[model samples]
Target: MPYVEVSLPVRAERSEIYPILKEMEKYPEFMADLVSVEVVERKENSTITKWVSNVDGRIIKWTEVDLFDDANMHISYKQIDGDLKKFEGEWILTPVADGTEIKLTVDFEFGIPMIAGLLNPILKKKVRDNSLNMLTAIKERMENRA
Candidate 1:
């Protein structure tokens, strides 16, 4: 398994950031890697979403279930089925002196044991960079939105 965690401090309140995070469909508007997101199903506290993303010219697709905890400013998601063997993580938002600190954690497994050692490191770095880009995009959007 490969895990990647990225955090960013944003000059925005949790109330403002949480809504944007929940609106996964808008991701492609800011996050270039994301091609499309469709909400397959929705509930008061959870949603099933299908996503298509471009990674280094490869098209990766997945369907995930997201659980949102509004009171705690937390969101967790796990892939029901995807290109990767495992894809699950959480987004945590906490208040800080300046604004809010947002963190993202992703745990994934490519399901190839024979070349695991050779591929894991490269995959981990790609995922980490993608995650950081997402956080940076959100930060810029939040800070500049007025």
Candidate 2:
């Protein structure tokens, strides 16, 4: 398994950031690498979302369940089905003096045990870069809006 985490400060309140984060389906509008995000199902505090993302010209698709913890300023998601063997992560926001500190953590695995040793390092970097890209995208959007 490979794990990666990235964090950045956003010029906005947790209150403002939480809603935009809750609206997962609007990601593509601000994140160019995201192809689309559709709400497949909804529950009181969770949702099943279908996602299509482009990474280095490769398309990756997945359906994930997202649980929103508005009171805690957090949201976590795990893939139910996807191109990857495993994918899960969480977004956490904490109030900071100037704004909010947002963190994105991703855990993933390619599931190829035979090549795990050889690929884990490379894959880990890729996942980390992707995670950073996601945080960067969100920060850009929220900061510009503020």
Tens-digit lDDT track of model 1 for 11-89: 9999999999999989999999999999999999999999999989989899999999999989999999889899999
Candidate 1: C-alpha lDDT: 0.95
Stretches of candidate 2 exceeding 4 Å from the true structure: none
TM-score of model 2 vs. true structure: 0.94
lDDT: which candidate is best? 1
- Whole-model lDDT, model 2: 0.90
Query: Ten consecutive residues with minimal summed lDDT in candidate 2?
Result: 126-135
Query: Residue 64 CA error for candidate 1 (Å)?
Result: 0.4
Candidate 2 lDDT tens digits, 1-146: 88888899998889988988899999898887889999999998999999999878889899999999877979999999998899999999988999999999889888789998898898788777877887888888888873
Q: Per-prediction RMSD in angstroms?
A: 0.7, 1.3
TM-score (all chains, Cα) for each model: 0.98, 0.94
* True lDDT of residue 14, candidate 1: 98
Clashing pairs in 1: none
